[model samples]
Structure formats: structure tokens, C-alpha cells
Target: MKRAFVPPADALIAFETAARHGSFTRAAEELHLTQGAISKQVRQLEDRLGVELFRRVRQRIVLTDAGRLYLHEIRGPLLDLTAATRQVMSYAGSEDVLNLAVLPTFGTRWLAPRLGDFQKRFPKAGLNISVRLQPFDFGAEPFDGAIHHGDPVWAGAIAEPLFDEEMIPVASKVFRDRHDIATPADLVKAPRLQLSTRPLAWRQWFDQAGVAADTAFQGSRFDQFGMMSEAAINHLGAALLPKFFVRHELAAGRLIRLFDISIAQRSAYYFVYPENRTLRPVVSTFRNWLLEEARTERTDPETMLPS
Candidate 1:
């Protein structure tokens, strides 16, 4: 029988942090401990395990072969332990927090307002929202749940669709004043705001609308929809924006749809969680509530309109 193995949780934490960051100083900062303390704990772990975990490079630390092997052995368990502890603690508290990763625009305009009902029903369930850009990788990140738009085939996760997102061409009132975009030919003369790396948006929209323009519709490109929306609102150029993200702007007349043409995006928002994670009581509770909300959104019919 292998000797029963045991290590202090704190020491394991220190080792895991140091290994992940490759820096005792960074581990110390994260753990709120002195560098000497972190270093000592790591050294002790190595001594007890009878392995040289790391080598002292000129100034930086490099994982020794032993250290690399140990990290591979221990990293998964440590991360799982941390995640389980957090989920349990969240359940134990009066504030039931659901850490959600969402698209910035949709979280603000679509989900945030409606969350009030979720709070009312489960008053204890508090929501903590974080932003995730498109093409997010859930594997490497420490997110409990994510709302994104894409194919639902994330490596080891399950996706629940919220709704299909449609985009419409929009611009500030001021932009229309300066340009003659009465027709698609005229639109070519104006600037086209680009959002992220979605390359086929302009061509697809124009093609669907039975119109075409200078294939090189040019303007400033933005990595986030929020930035592109701002640029459009500021009279910079035309942006194909999702109605759900800018319902307020459209309702308040801050933005005007240049045309009623809407395109069904190949992707839509989804709520995804890792299939392998141990679902704690809190995680289950939050997941149940989110599914309920998605169902409500689907049936309400009225929610489909730009509010």
C-alpha cells in the first residue's frame, strides 16, 4: 500500500499558486503573504516530497523536471478543491451569488433589468456579472457560467440557448445629416463601422438586402460591440448593432435604424457551464433559475421587441 499522502492545504495553495504563475512574488501577492513566507512554504513542500521543485535561475524561477511533474499531478485537484470550496461558501451565505460571464452589451441592456424578478423570486440569489468577449475559451478561465454567441460545442461544456440575435444598421441622427444614404449606392459613400473580426457582416447584409456597395466599405474597427455602438452614437459611422443591446438608445431616439433590414446571426447568446464540474447546491440553484429565465424570455413574446 502507498503511504497515505497528506499535505497542508496552505502549503498546497502556495505550491499551486507558485507553479501556475512561475513566480513566488506573484503567489505571495495573491495569497496576501510575504515573499519569504511563500518561498519557505514551497521549499518545505519540496523537502517533504523529496524533490527539487524549482531551480533558481539568475532572478526568475524555473520549474525543475520534478516540479513540472508534481504540478501536473496536483494542479487539477487543487483547482477543483478551490472551486468546490467557493461554491459551498457561496451557498452558506445569505447572499446566493451566481458568478456569470456575459457579453457586456447584452448583460447591461437585456439581462440586468430583468434580473430583478430573479431576485424577487429567489431573494437570496444575488448575481455577479462579468464580461466575456466573443470567441471565449471556457477551458482556461475560472468562470462558473458564461453567456456567449457561437456554436455550442465548447470542449467539455453544455450550452443552453437564450435567443437568436439579429442586427440592424444604425447611426446617429447627426451622421444621416452629413451623408446621402437614401439608397445602398449612397451607403457606400459613408463609413462602415466594423465590430471585431466578423468579416462577412457587411457583404452578407448587403447581399441579403438585394444591394451592394463598394466592396471596401471602410471605417474604424472595434474589438467590442460597446465601443462600436458608442462610435455610431457619436456620429462616427454606420454600425450593424443588435437591437437587444441598444434597445434604450433606439427607444430614446439616440440612435436611428438606417433601414429595417435585420440579419439572423449564425450565433446567438447561450448559457454554458462545464459538464464535469461538481455542481454544488449554489451552482444548481443558480442554474435552475437561469434556465427558468431563459424559458420566460422565450415565451414572453413581448421580450422579442426592443425595449
Candidate 2:
């Protein structure tokens, strides 16, 4: 049995595009070629296939019956081929996916709520998240990027500022009612839930309030904010927590501010990514979106501090 001769893939692509668009000019524009180039390729395809692929109608082109049917058959395959080719090229140029390391508290309280918008925008990209403790070695980690507090200080990585963190004293309404804390001195007697990262949180809060608690005041300590927050909500005690971490809870009345005093921390959050040529697509989109979000939040009067 003799097999039919096959035409070049480029010719088939040109013909398919021309047939679908019904205009060589539009097809050429889409393929980044001249109209004459597209017409020539389509003509070559027609000659090779021995079929009239298009008909001239009042100085415009229309696909013939054969052309339409051929297109219907080849269009799906052509699109699939194009998508597959793009995927391969993307893999060659950049990472297959992005992995993000984040502090658990901020991830849950702040970043997690807003991740849907990022996914909606870049649904093709894959995102994997892990909870990170401080003083981590990036070289030892699989994370392509990290949302971290304070300076990243990691060599050979690009660090972009995400947002500043400010600490404030927060307690559950039930806890506050039970303790009846009216002044900084009163907070000393209250059980204080603490984060291991900020061991001196209670001391700092008390110092800012002009009252000194027994630096030895024993209370619960946790390695993560989510746990501490849950404890606070359960009325375990007051936690010296970040304002941003508890913004949603505070707004919802799940947690109430013990005092109006806020101390801007020396540490601020930064988005850190390894300095590599194979950039993850999601990282750029996320970074840009976060910067824009920060800008909007900075200008909004509701988020600003009183003059």
C-alpha cells in the first residue's frame, strides 16, 4: 500500500489559521507573518492537498466546504499541539512550578485570604506552600521563594519588600473581661500567650505601656502565630501579636485590642526568591500584585495612622 505525501507542519498551520479566520491578512497578523507569506503558504498547502481550500468573494476570502471540514478536524489537534509546544517552551525557559515558604501566622491570617485572587489571575501556575521558621538556610530548602519577616539576608537571592509589621497587644473579649485589665500594670497579672520568635514581646509591650511585668511571668509559648491566636481566642491569655496577623479577627470582634498602643517592629516582611535565570511565572505576578496592594493600602485613609 502507498501512503499519501504529507505537507510541512508550517504549511498546515498557515492553512488552518487562514481557513479559520477566513482572511489571510488576519491569519498573517496572528502568525507574525505578512499577508503574502500566509497566502503563499496556504496556496502551497492547497496544491499539496489537491483541494480548493478558499473561495474569493467580493475581494474577501471564505473557506470552502472541504476547508471547513478539514479545519473542524484539524483545529482541535492544532490547538492541542500549540498548547503542548508552549508548555514545553515554558518548561525550558522557567521552573515547572513555584514553591512558597511562609510564616504560618501571616499565611493564615493575612496571605491565605488573598491567595484566591492570585490563583484566579494565574491559574496555570502551580503554587506549593510550606510553613517556615526563622533563621532558615535557603540552600538547604526546596522553597523557590519565601515570604519572611525582617531582612532575608540570604546571599544570591532577590528580596522585595512586601509589608511592614507592627506589633500590638490583643486579647479575646472574654479574657479581657475576666482579667479586667484597665492599665499596663494590670496586664502583668494576666496570663500572656507568646510567640517563640518574639520572646520579649510581653516585655516590649509592657515597657511601651510604662509598666514592667515580671519578665519571669510564666505563660504559654508557641512556635507559630496560628496556635497562639487560637489560644487567645479560647481565652487562654493575651498574646502580643502583629496587627496584620489579627486584622481580620480584630475587625470581626473575635479579638479585641488591650490598648491603643502600637509599636512598629524593626522587622518587616519581604518576599525572597533565589536569584536564578529560570524565574517562576507566579512569583512575578504575586510580587507585582502585592506591591500594588501595598500601594493602595498605604494611600487608603482607613489604614493610615492619625496625624
User: lDDT per prediction?
Assistant: 0.78, 0.77
- Index of the highest-TM-score prediction: 1
Clashing pairs in 1: none
Question: Where does the lowest 10-residue lDDT sum fall in candidate 1?
Answer: 298-307
Q: Which stretches of candidate 1 lie over 4 Å from their true place?
A: 1-96, 134-143, 277-307
Per-residue lDDT tens digits for candidate 2, residues 196-257, read 87777677777787886775346888987889888998999988787777777887788888
TM-scores, all models, native as reference: 0.64, 0.61
Best by lDDT: 1
Worst 10 residues of 2 by lDDT: 298-307
* lDDT by residue (tens digit), candidate 1, 60-105: 8999998888889888888888777876676564665677788777
Candidate 2: stretches off by over 4 Å: 1-96, 134-142, 278-280, 296-307
